[model samples]
Target: MYEFFRDLDRRWIFLMMFLCVAVPIIIIGATGKTFPEEPTQLVRAVFDEIENLPSGSKVLLSYDYDPASEGELAPMATMFAYHCAAKGHKMYFMALWPVGPQMVDDTIENIIKKDFKDLKYGEDYVNLGYKSGYEGVIKVIITDFTELYSTDTRGTPWSAIPMCHDVNSVQDMDLIVNVSAGYAGTKEWVQYAVTPYPKLRMVAGCTGVQAPLLYPYIPQQLHGLLGAIKGAAEYEALVIEAYGDKMARKDAGDNPLTDDNGDYLIPGKYTEGIRRMGPQLVAHLLMILLIIVGNVIYFVERRREGRR
Candidate 1:
């Protein structure tokens, strides 16, 4: 058994990894069971920041990420849009990355337009679209929104949009929530927007690698943060727990069915980040087990050679 284990084929290891990932994913897809997420301080802060805001507050959502990092950032973006819309906040969407506008559009389609049909385009939310210039755009919009943005993404003049008529600059926003991947992202916002405008309240959801870099700015430059998918998962759990009943009631109207606790039903998609965690946990465990097994085989083989 020891000899066979020491000489294990590479293909067998690949097969084990394949099973580790695929089995959990298939089980989760069918049963909808996900690993439970406990809200970390960072995630809790993000949830509270949005929750504490008054209804109809103005929020600026900067999508500074592209599809390349969408898998990590999109879940939080979806939750952000949903939470703001549910809380009756007026959302102003803009992107620093060229493909960022598409990300915003996808969120609107999936979360806003699909879930909250009553939200009017220019009234409840407005898409300012993507603009050129890396941090240069952030610098310009920090003080003068009109100088950089005279029209929405679709070519409609800002004069036609009701939301744009009242805004003068980024400072006019009550809160700024940014979902970003890398450069021209959270760092740019902290420098160009929050740094210059100290009063501006900002929360950000960024890739895992960027989280540590931004930690020093917490509670000062950044009000809250969601770091990578783990942060997204925790935040998603918090939002769902707080707002699930409200969503169920809204969707079902009068005489909606409730669970034992009287909370209404919510869609499965709301817990997507959590659901993905199941596969992640299983894959990680499998990797750890494989490492232990490999090390054991190495030591056993080394001992046998020494004895011979």
Candidate 2:
């Protein structure tokens, strides 16, 4: 057994790791099923902030990541948009990163355009698109929005958009939902917008590595936070659990019954974060097993060498 383990090809371990991730993904994708999640306090706080908002409340969604971090960040973005749309909040989409606008568009297309078709653009929601000044843009917009954003992404004047009619600055927003991957993201919003205006409520979702750095601002500058895909999964679970049946009824035009296992027939797009967690969980377990096996082999060989 010692010799066998010692001689085990590195390629075999690589194959095991690949299978560990791929199999769960395939199963979850095919079945539309995902492992259950228990939301952390921070995740629940994010859900509560959006849930507690009255219908028709104005919400500003800042997408601060690009395609490179989409795999980690997009799920939360989609969930945030979906939750706000379902709650009947008026959304104002904008970005600090150059490619952030595209992320906003993608979320709108996938969630609002696809599921909630009754929502009208420029009234219920508007895409303000990307701005170039980073934190500087946040600093300006906190006081006077028109100082920078005079037009929406489609070249329509901000004055023309019904949603922007009463908006003078970011202070007008009932809540701010920010999804960020790096610099000039949640930190910038917290510093330039929420910190200065204590009444301006904010919540954020960020990459796993960035979560720790932003925790200090929570409950004060940031109302809540979602960290990486795990955080996204937890938030998604909360939203689906609360609103899935209502959404199903909306689609079927009547009350819809649960599936055989007592689950709502929610769309796959809404479950992206949950589905992603399956592979992540499996991959982590596989890595732990591999580490244990490697250590056993190392110790066994050392003992043999000492005896000889």
Candidate 3:
């Protein structure tokens, strides 16, 4: 066994790694099954901040990422919309990045339009659309929203939109939820909007690389934070466990259908983060195993050379 493994071609190792990742993804895609996730304190904080809010509370959802970071950012963004809509919060969607409006549109289409069809636009929610000037936009809107944003994305004036009628600035919002990739994102919101006002509450979802930098503001300027796909998966699990029909049925003393793996059936849209995590988890394990085996082989070879 040692001899064969010692002489194993690099191609074989590559093949094993490929199978490690590909097999899980294919199985998950086919089965609609995902591994369970235990949400951390940070993720739970994000969920709670939204969950605890009173229904009809105004929430500013600032999606500041473009398509380039969509895979990492979109899942949480979708969940943020789903959770807010589920709670009957009045969503105010806006963007800092030029492409952010499209991201906002995608979330609105996928989660709100598809799932919460009864929600009326302008009253239940409104798209304030993208504004240039990055943090400058934040600075202005924090004081007088109409100074920078006088209309919704559809060109309807703010005075015309029922939700905007009472909303004068970010200060009027019950909570601010930000999905960000870089500058003019969570950090800027914290520094400009939350810090000075101190009355304004905020939470954020950001890329893995940006998570650490924003951690210091948590439970203070930022109520909670979700970092990267893992954070998204954990938050998804919490949301699904809370609101998914299968879990509801199970709680109601009915038997809920489960997959062969005993995992509860979940909608494909809500499982993006979990499905993506499957390949990553398997590949990481494979890498770990390879490192251990290579170390064992190196030590064994050193012993043999010493004996000779």
Going through the candidates in the order shown, the clash numbers are 0, 0, 0
As for model 2, its CA RMSD to the true structure in angstroms is 2.1
Least accurate stretch of 10 residues (summed lDDT) in model 1?
248-257
Model 1: how far is 187 from its true place, Å? 1.2
lDDT of 1 by residue, 1-308 (tens): 77767788989888988888789889988975577789998889999989999999999999999999998889899999999999999999999999999999999998898888999999999999999998999899988898989999888888899977788899999999999899999988999999988989999999989999999999899989999888989998898888776555443355545667565555666776777787778778988988998999888778989999
Better of 1 and 3 by lDDT: 3
Compared with the true structure, what per-residue lDDT tens digits does model 3 show for residues 262-289? Answer: 6566667887887889998998898999
lDDT, model 1:
0.88
- Residue 211 of model 3: what lDDT? 97
For each candidate in turn, the TM-score is 0.89, 0.92, 0.85
**Which digits, one per residue and each the tens of the lDDT, describe model 2 over residues 56-90?**
99999999999999999998999999899999999
Candidate 2 runs further than 4 Å off: 1-10, 249-254, 297-308
How high is the CA lDDT of each candidate model? 0.88, 0.92, 0.90
Alpha-carbon RMSD to native, per candidate: 2.6, 2.1, 4.2
